[model samples]
Structures are given as structure tokens and as C-alpha cells.
Target: MVFFGKKSPITGKQNARKTTGLKAASTRSIINKYHQLNKRKLQLQGLKKRMKKAEEQAKEAEIDAEITQIDSEMEKLGGLEVYQKASLKGQDQTRGGDSSHVLLKWLKNEGNELALEEGQEKKLLEVGCLSVSNAVSKSTEFDTIDRIDLRSNDPLIKQQDFLKRPLPKSDQEKYHVISLSLVLNFVPVTADRGKMLQLTTKFLHPQGLLFFVLPKACVENSRYLDGELFDSIMASLGYEKLEETTTDKLIYQLWRCRQEKAKYQKFTKNEVRSGSTRNNFCITL
Candidate 1:
């Protein structure tokens, strides 16, 4: 679910891009447009959900039309798969090819205080999974890795939305680790994002690990969210940050469930901070 820059939509050339300022500018442009389109798509999806709930025909047709338009645009821009490939390419060109390295590191770190009983097999859920060959998938740490994405054609990655997945009924059905890499920001509705977070508790084993990843800007530069605020939200949900790392483009955090559904603060879209060019990323409960 990693989202970042991509190949030039028109030229599709990278030799020149590899050695000049033009590459950075091109990457920024593609990434910006990618985020813009993704935001609009999620908004339309939220509207569609409301339309389904209300069972009203008044705005349904128009909403469907707009969604079609956006889908067409996304198809031309290569969908999320292309963005993921581009992200992998950058990783190959510079750092490691996936965020799983960090997640695995967090799990192995001694600072993670969640002590597991010996011989306890680990189960992992990789939401918004794009590939079956990812590091976590191949790792021996987990007894099993259930990979899923909202849109996927690969047989290995189930094409199912996490929100729609059946809720776990018992500890046996819950996962030991859940990877939410770059998936939260894709959730357009602020409340829905919070709902998604809360829902994780039902699917996770007590004291399980959750690896959360987001674009650096979501916390660093968003008008509605900041580092402290995001921390409070997770803490209120009973998730304690075990480790956190911020790169130039991404925010990675490994959290342990301390308590589930604890008393928490409620937040809204009120202006918490002001900036002329800030992103409107926020989560609510």
C-alpha cells in the first residue's frame, strides 16, 4: 500500500530523470496528483456508502457518474499498482524494497514489551497487500500471512476490503500482527478512518502488534493532525507506541495493544493548527 512518486505519465522516460533535478520535480508532481485523485475517489466512495444507506435515488446517479469519471482517470494514471511499483523501484534504487524490514525489526526489538508465551505461533494480516513476495510474506516469523487488498488480481492477494472482512469471534481468529502500511490515509472520511482503527481491536489478539505507516506529511504538515494529536488518538484507543521512525517521506510506527476500547478523547475537524498549504488529514472517534 505504499504510495509515492511514479513514472512520467506522458514521457515515461527515466534515464534523464535519474541524474537531474527534473527527476525530483517529476516525482513530486506525480505523487501530488496521485494523492489528489485518491482523495477524490475516497470521497465519492463515502458518498456511495451513504447513498446505499439512505436508499435515495436523488444523488445516486450523479455520484455514480463522478465515480466512473474518477475511476477512468485512475486507470490512465496506472492505478495503485503502478504507484506501488514506482515505490518499489525507488526502494531498489536507494534503500530496501519494502516497509516490512522495519516492521520485522520492530517485532524483534527488545524494547517491544509484549512478551509472548513460548511456542505461540504468530499470525499476520497484511491489509492492502500488493504482492505475495514481500519480506513479511517470506519471513519465518509468522505461522501464516493473510494478504488482502481492496483491488487485486493476483491469486495470492485476496481482493477484499478490510472493513468488509468478517469480524473475529475469538482469539483463535485474531491475528498476532496487522500491517496497515499507507492504508489509513487512503480512507477519505475522517470518521471512517477512526472506525477502521477501532475495528482493528476486534481483529487483533490482545497485546498484538500493529505496524502503522503513513506519508510524513499526514502528521508533520496536516492542518487537522500533528504528531502529538496522532499519538493521543492511538493512545486513547489503547495502542502504545513501541517504536517510531520518520524518514523524509514516511512515518512508520510499531504499536502494541495495551488495552482495547479504553476511555478516549473525541476529536473533530476543528482547526487545531493553521497553515496556508497544509493537508487536511484528520482522524475522529
Candidate 2:
């Protein structure tokens, strides 16, 4: 509900922050622009590395200048954390859907079928949590709902990176479920995506559930990922896919931790799917 009063690029004035919400196109444009700038920054950095090795001092300097400019623009957009908050706004009920809301409804309908111990309370760890009152937070299904994000806008959500979260001292400290909706794709490093998946297993109890979600384009339209490859990746990490739901915009999946110790397999960034305009999304394990 807070606005930083960031100026509108189109109007050259403070964008009227409305509680109602932005036009769908306007919201989408902001998100797309952020992605374009981020991708360009990475591309330029790669080119600069090559230029430095070739002794092209002048070209490298030019790249640095571009990088500095990009950094300024990144600040103007309020960086990834702020951009994510903006995206969350777009997912508000007024705008059509909140992913957590759907997750809550799905869980409620399938509550009886979940692998939970009779009369025992379950705990959940929600990574990339942005709000204190998200649907899952209000649900009674979980006795404890621990929320964390890279940065905190509210006191309720711990301001810590999930990757750096301390190891649990006992089984009680581990969670029965872990949620990572719309989280993995935001990780800037491709390899870290795999690492994050690996670390989630350590934070969950035996037979724990993992709720993972991503933009459909990540697996459906990317150059290096597909349904089969994604399944294999999860299987290699000792997770058995329990549920999968696909929509025009996103893919939601539930995976159960399994002790398939002998089934572990190494994965790499290979071109499993390809097309000229497909996105370059891949996980290296």
C-alpha cells in the first residue's frame, strides 16, 4: 500500500500510485523492462570478460560505462526485491490472482489425502514470503508457518537469505513443507537454482512436501528445459512429483521427499529444448 512515488517513464511525473492497481499492460511492461535490463547487464558483463582477455582495453572501458549506466537504471527500478514487490501487487486479487491464495484452496481440498501423521501438527517454511497475511499464513493446516525473504519490508518476515539459513539442530527445527512459489527464476545465477533445490531437502523432514512454482516459459518455452528434464532433475534430487498444475502463465508442482539414494543423477545445462526466440533458462547440477 506504500508507494515510493517513482516517476512514470511515459508521463515524466510521479506515477499515480493507486490502491485499485495498474492497468495490466502497464504492470506487465514494468516487469518486462526490468527483465530486459537485467539480461542486458549479464550479456554485457560476459562480453567485457572476453574483451579483457583479448587486451581490448578501450572496449572493456566502454562496457564498464554501460554497466554503470545499467546499475543506475536498476536503482531507479528499485532492484530485484522492490521489483518483486511490484510483481506481487500485480498478482493481487484485484488484478486476478494471488498464487498463495490458489495454493491454500488446493491444500484445503486435498487435506485428507496429504501424508500427515494423524492428529499431529505440521510446520511449513515459506521462502520468498512478501506479506505477513498471505493465504498460507492464515491457514490452520500448518501449526507453524515460518517466513523468510532476502530482504524484509515487514517485521514478521525474517530478513535473511534462505541459502544462508542456519542448519537445524533437531528434527523439530526442520519443516514438514517448504514453499518456493515464483522464487527460483528470480535467482540471478543459474547454478544456484540447483543448489537451492538441493538445500531445501536438508531443511525438510522425511517425506516432506515441497511446493515449487515458476513461470510456464521457464520450462515450457526455454531453450534448455522441458517437462521430461524437469522431472528428471527433481527425481535426481530425491523428490517424487505428486502433483502438477499448469496454466497459461505458470506451472505449480508438489513434490515429496523420497529416500532414493541410489537414483541420484548429475545434471548439466544442456539444450533439451530449442527455438530461436526461446528464453535462456537452465539449471546446472
Candidate 3:
């Protein structure tokens, strides 16, 4: 009787395939969790709005608690972009975030206001510029634009740790405009954020402009910073606030570097502003 040896069910190739499948599933699960949390957060926001409109104080309090819980969970998971790598494959390529649109509009409306000769090249430095194709497209008026990011792989983006290294001599205080969109929030410490601001000034000309974008939470959630306090801090750093806009989600400000010492001498713990009124200060250049 001829008997065929029993074939093993698990070969090396099969095991490798199984591992790959498991990894892909894990990635999908993470992405799904992120989206679910995001969707729930939006829903809670709507509920909060309706509760406020109806003047249901009790219901509004409950919804506020739920929203706070969600925010805590999101913070644990490393913010809304935790699964960005996995979701990028399926996300709409055309949709730029709200901040990008704001930056584009600012560029279009204010690009010419910079004191440069009509034909002179304006040097611009953009930090944390992940996939700045939209910003670049809107910046055709600029003579030269340099973009840098720590994580981006785009050939046009210089991959460098902005906090660790000094800029080349040729680039020091050479840029006429520097744009930093949602970059400060990544620095976890408040002092480090201030340090980052200081470093940014090193790359800007004496009267150059810094277009800054940050999450509105920075002002609302911090006991140390309010609208007026933030303005004072900027002034102390030699930045004169040219314009500012505060929305529900983000804060946009345009400041010109004066290369002067901080005019505000003290920062007291008791100096917190009382109310939570959103400030939208703007000036015509």
C-alpha cells in the first residue's frame, strides 16, 4: 500500500503571510478606532450646541463631561492624526485642512504688503510643512520658498530636526517671511514652545513677518496664557502683532520681528485673564 506523507499545514511562507495579514488588520483597527472617536466627538459637539440652544443646563453639563472624556481619550491616543499613515491611503487627496486654507488666503491677500521691491525676490521659510503643495501653489509670487519637516519624505522638503541643529549661515536671518502652522503644539512644554519661538526669530529678518497658527486650546486651556497675555509674551519676544484671528478651532496671528527686548518685564501666576472671550484682533498694514 502506497501512503503519501501527511503535508504540514504551516510552511514558512504561509506563516509570513499570516503575520502580514495580522499586521494589516491591526492597522485597520487602529484607523477605525481613530475615526470612531472623531465621529463621536463631532456628535457630542452637535449635542452640546442643541443643548445650549434649548437652555438645558443639566443636559449641557452631561454633554460637556462626555466631551471632556473624549478629549482625554484622544490625548492618550496621541491626538487626531495617530493613524495618519494608514488613513492617508484612503483619505481624499484634495481636501486640505482648515488652517491650510487660511494660510493660502493670507498669502494671497497679504503677500504684496511685505516691504520688498516689485521685482525683488522674497525669501520665505516654512517649518513643519507636510505636503505643502497647496501652499506652494499659492506662493507663486515668492522668489524663493524653503520648506522643512522632520517626518516628511518629499524630495522638496528638507528633513531636519528644527530643535537640534543650527541653520546654515546663508539661511540665518535671511528669510523675509516664516510660516509656522500648528508647529508649536507639538512641543509639549510651554518653555520649549517659547524657545521654539526664539529660534524662529533667528531665521527672520529684522522686520520680517511670522505667520503663526496654533490650536485655540493653547489659550483657553492654559492658566498662563490669555489673549492679552499672549500678546504681551509676543511683544516681549520682539514680535509686534500685526494681525490675529481666533476661531473655534485655531488661532492665526501675523507678527513682525522688531529684534528688540521684551517690553513686558514680568509674568505673574495671578495675571490670568478672567473671562473666556475669544479675541480677533487685526490691523491693516
Estimate every model's Cα lDDT from 0 to 1.
0.73, 0.75, 0.60
Count of backbone clashes for each model? 0, 0, 1
Q: Where does candidate 3 stray beyond 4 Å?
A: 1-98, 107-112, 117-120, 168-173, 261-285
Model 1 regions lying over 4 Å from their true place: 1-31, 44-66, 90-96, 113-119
lDDT by residue (1-285, candidate 1, tens digit) is 212122233223322123222343455554555567778767666656756445554667666766666565556556666555444454443543488888988877897744456776678889878677777777888888888888774898888888889998767788888899888987777998988888887787888888999989888889999998888888888998889998888999998886745667787776778979998899888
Index of the highest-TM-score prediction: 2
144-204: candidate 3 lDDT, tens digit per residue: 8888776664787788767765764863337888888767765533455676777777888
Give all TM-scores, in the order shown.
Answer: 0.79, 0.82, 0.59
RMSD after CA superposition, every candidate? 6.5, 6.0, 16.6
Candidate 2: 10-residue stretch with minimal lDDT: 1-10
Per-residue lDDT value at 213 in model 1: 92
CA error at residue 228 for candidate 3, angstroms = 1.6
- Tell me which residue pairs clash in candidate 2: none
